[model samples]
Target: MKKITTPLKEKDIRALKAGEEVLLKGVIYTARDQAHKRLCDLIKKRRQLPFALKNQIIYYCGPTPAPPGKIIGSCGPTTSSRMDKFTIPLLKNGLKGMIGKGKRSAEIISAIKKYKAIYFLAPAGAGAYLSKFVKKKELISWPELGTEAIFRLEVEDFPLIVGIDIKGRSIYDKR
Candidate 1:
């Protein structure tokens, strides 16, 4: 498995291939559907985003509240396609990578290639297991959104599979 850190660089993203396993480290932000909408709104209004999109990664998740004595709770990837409507703007805004579950749409695949970005698939139905990898967590914005709020997490050796690479290769494609 390839081991990498964030914020992801163009070189690192380019070096990955569809279906490759990876161990991701460093910071990643969690954002679910609602948070994604808000972010897209920010981008559309030409307002500053809560975090830099350039060379950064967003994980599609709405983590449960941290349990006592644990740094985090069930935190795993949500479906990737749910965010498709908002993806292009983020890519254009310089988002380097995304970590989520499931396949992406054709348009998103094309956008990923056009923008030189990447999509990684985190293990689904493994939130409790994945939480162990989170070393730290901090709310980034919209606390009212609860679990759907954006959060910055510091993770170590988080496992993922390359769902789509910059070259337009998709794991969902026929062999």
Candidate 2:
């Protein structure tokens, strides 16, 4: 697996290709549908975002409450399409990567290319297993959204596959 670090540089993002396996290490942020909507609203209003987007990766997950003695609980990718409406704006704001599962829309794919971004897919139904990678977690914004609240996470060797590359190539494409 190709090992990569978070807060990816543009050159690092450009090096990725669809279908490549990667082990991501470093800090990543979490946000699901509700959080995404809030972020988009902030952008539309020309208000500052809670976090900077440049060179960042947003993981589409709403982790369950941690069990006793654990850093986090059952963290896994959510269906990415649900957040498509907010994606282009985020990309334009300098977001470099996204982590989620399943196919994305044509508009999203186009935006990814236009913005020179990449999309990654974590294993589906492997939340319990995936949580093991999260070394630390902190609520970052939108506490009212509960599990859907945005969070800052520190992860080590979080496995994923490049679902879509900056070139607009997608793993979901039938061979």
Question: Residue 32 CA error for candidate 1 (Å)?
Answer: 1.0
- RMSD (CA, Å), candidate 1 to true, equals 0.8
lDDT of each: 0.94, 0.94
Candidate 2 regions exceeding 4 Å error are none
Give the least accurate 10-residue stretch of model 1, judged by summed lDDT: 6-15
Q: Taking the tens digit of each residue's C-alpha lDDT, what string does model 2 give over 26-47?
A: 9999999999999999999999
Question: Please, what is the TM-score per model?
Answer: 0.98, 0.98
Each prediction's RMSD over C-alphas, in Å, is 0.8, 0.8
lDDT by residue for model 1 (40-116), tens: 99998999999988889999999989989999999989998999999999999989899999988999999999999
| Residue 71 in candidate 1, Cα distance off native in Å | 0.6
Which clashing pairs does model 2 show?
none
